[model samples]
Target: MTASSTTTPALAKEVALLAVLATLWGASYTFIRIGVETIPPITFIAARTLIAGGLLVAIIKMRGLSLPKDPAIWKRFFIQACINSVIPFTLIAWAEQTVNAGLATILNSTTPIFAFLLTVLITRHEAVTMRKLLGTIAGVIGISLIIGMEAFQGVGKELVAQLAIVAATISYAAAAIFGRGFKGLDPMMPAAGSMICGAVILIPVSLVVDQPWTIAPSADSLLALLGLSVFSTALAFVIYFRLIHTLGSVSTTSQAYLRVPIGVGIGVIFLGETLASTALTGLVFVVIGVAAMTFPSRKKTVPV
Candidate 1:
């Protein structure tokens, strides 16, 4: 087969996988909102990580893949778990108590912005370019539009919740950079190991703070929790790794751009949520900014 013909089908498949991954992650916000209505944030996150971690373990065993036994590697997994899963999941759940799912997804899409800033400032992995600088400014403006002047007027709990979600996105960015240490390992191992570590950290906190044993969650909440773990966490990770391998990191990360609209659609149809005109406009700018940040730039070739 010609190179063009072969590349076309592969690209199409990757695009399809990207859409599916985006939908799965986008629906996660809606599920978390449903779950947090009855479940405490700590307990909900604990259950999510444990369930998802268990599913990954099963997959690993079924595939006859063995996880690394090095203590240093496990430690890295612990750090990654705290940053990527435990912190972010708990924050998002808490935030959703006051913030709507759609808006939360919009803010969470700022992960790439945080990632870029972290790379340039802390890691020095990439240099700041004009396109990236403009993208970062656009993201800031978009966030301001979404939050609006009204959010600052009252110093309300809602404003704090929104900030917490932003903090979570920053943690996610840090995790992305930190995760590079596991470049040689099987992707499933890091995913499964980190989730397992997250469960360990969260379970005790949930018991102490939430006393989850004392609370009887509703059927809907339980189902939502199940969906969050099985579909969003477990299945999504599988698809994510496949995309990273097949489409490369830049193409895979572009899934963040698709997630906002899918999340907004799910929130509106199922949760009866609505976005303000400004927030909708903000969403557009945020998507464009993130696209600029993550979409790989083409190298200009000078005539030899």
Candidate 2:
């Protein structure tokens, strides 16, 4: 068999893996909305991370994976946890209060564009090309259109919330870049450790900030919280690791694009969301931009 044949199969697997990641992340917005309806945003995020962290730790133990014992590595893990889990998790929850899940998901989909720029600018790792540059431009335009159309009616506060969600995407981009540091560690162990640290930081903050014990939620909301903690946060991490192992970080994180469409589909089907023609046009641009940015460019000329 030729080397080219093997590479094609691997690329196919990477694409498929990213698609699964997209589905898991896209559904998270809906679950978050349901959970936050009765649970305070801080409480929901803290508890969600805590429970997911515990589950991940258990899975790591079962798999016999080891976390880094070095203090420096542990510190990095803590930072990654804070950036990837705690900050974005809480921010998105708070932002979702005023924003619908679909719109929030659309805003969050900007992670890849940010990741591309960060990789090129800060890390000096990847080169930016004309196609990717154009795609990133189109992606920004798409996001602007979506935000402009959806957020006009409730301008001031809603705009802030939308920007907060975009900030969460920036955090996610940083996390994706920062996560490269953990290449040598077993993915599960670092993943678990980070969540453990995140939960530690968030739990105290949630208790102090939200005082969630004072408020109780309806049974439906409670169930939603359970689903958010278990499925969205915990299981999602497990699947994410598998994808990361199969695809490189950039490929795996490309799931950010697909999340928006899935969120929109769920909104139309379940939440009864009605998109204006303008919003739909913007959605088309998003799809085009994602396809442009994520398609892996091939080099037929090999270096000797």
Candidate 3:
């Protein structure tokens, strides 16, 4: 079999996985909206991560996969948990209190732009190409357009809430680049470990801040929390790691673009939200700019 022919099916499978990832992640905003309606944000986030972490750890033990035992590695694992699970998760949940879920997801798509800029400025690992720089600029413009200048004009708390959502996007981007530190560990181990650490960290914070013992939740809210823990937090990370393994970071991150359309559809169908013409144009730009940023630019050279 020729190399190109052999590789085509692998590429096709990765694309399919990304599509599924996009759908799952897109629906997550809807689930978060449902969840936050009844449950306090900090408590809800902490509980979901805890449950998801416990589930993954159980699975790992059942499968007999060896997890790292070094205290140093464990520290990094804890940091990874904070970056990947704790901070951004909390930020997005709180931001969703005021911001629409769809718009929030669209802003979250700027994560790769942050990842790229961070890679260039912080690590000095990857050089900034003109295409990537242009893509980042366009993405910022697109996000600004989506939120609209008018929304910014006459606002008080709502404007700050929107800014918080944008800040969450920055956290996500930092997390993406920061997670590159986990290159040597088994992928599933890091996924499971960080979740476990996040649970540990969030438990104390959630107890003190949210005081779940006092806050009552409806049955529907409980179910939403279960879905968030099981599907969005646990299963989502597994699929994310699998995609990264198969397609690398660049391709896996491109799935962010798909979240916008998916979130928009969910918003209209479930939340009864109206879409503006301006939002549509901004969505198109975000989709295009993210695609431009993530599409593979490197071509394999043939050796004689």
Candidate 4:
């Protein structure tokens, strides 16, 4: 057997894992929607990090590995937690209370676009190309359209929520850029460490402000929280790390736009939600723009 025969099945497996990652993350939008109904955003996200972090820790231990002993590494983990989880996760949970799950999915799915722009401006990590420049313009236009279309409805609080999701998208972009600093470490280290650090940061805030004990979350909310913590956050992180290792960051994150449609479908079917015609149009632009940003160019491009 030649090298081509050996590599094909492995490549196919990575692609399959990417699809699974999209579904898990896509479902998280509905989970947050259901959870934030009764659970406050900070408390909900705190629990999510804590539960998922514990699971990752256990997995590491079972593998006969331990988290880094260096304080510097843990400090970096803390920063990662802020951008990757603590801030963005809380923002998404809070926003989902007002924003529909489907819209949240579309808004948050622009990570690669922002990552690309950041690369162009600050990092200069990736090669600039005509396609990427056009992609950036399309993404900005798509976002503007979504917000502008919503404004006609006089969605005051919803506007703030939408912007919050956008900010979360920015945080995700920075996280991706900073995540490159972890190229030499085991992928699970950042995934697990940042989660644990996020828990440490948020749990105290949840107790003091939300007083989560006083809140009586419903069965659906509890179930959603569990699902979000386990399947979406922990398992999805594991799969994402695996894909990043096997498929490369560009390939792994590129498939994330698939979560947009999956999230919208879950909201429509499970939550009985519907999007306005204008919003649907915006979603189309986002998908197309992200495709332009992330899809492998036929032309030669530099990877940083």
Q: Number of the top candidate by lDDT?
A: 1
**TM-score of structure candidate 3:** 0.92
Pitting candidate 1 against candidate 2, the one with the higher lDDT is: 1
The regions of model 4 sitting more than 4 angstroms off are 152-155, 298-304
Ranking by lDDT: 1, 4, 3, 2
Candidate 1 or 3, higher lDDT? 1
What C-alpha lDDT do the candidate models reach, one value each? 0.93, 0.80, 0.81, 0.91
Give the TM-score of each candidate.
0.96, 0.89, 0.92, 0.95
Q: Predict model 2's lDDT versus the native.
A: 0.80
Q: What total of clashing residue pairs does each candidate reach?
A: 0, 0, 0, 0
**Cand. 4 TM to true fold:** 0.95
lDDT tens digits, residues 217-292, model 3?
8887788789878887778788888888889877788788877788778877988777567767777878877887
Which 10-residue span in candidate 2 carries the lowest summed lDDT? 247-256
- Please provide, for model 2 over 1-304, each residue's C-alpha lDDT reduced to its tens digit, 9 standing for 90 to 100: 9888999988887677667667777888888877788889888888887888899988877887656689998899899988898889889999888787887777777777887888888997887799889888887888788778547676688788888898898999899889888887888877788888988888898889888888788887778778777877778788888876777555665676778788877766766767767667777777667667777787598666
Work out how many backbone clashes candidate 2 has: 0
- Flag clash pairs in model 1: none
lDDT of 1 by residue, 208-236 (tens): 99999899899999999999999999999
Return the candidate ranking by TM-score, descending.
1, 4, 3, 2
What's the lDDT of the predicted structure labeled candidate 4?
0.91
Name the better of 1 and 3 by TM-score: 1
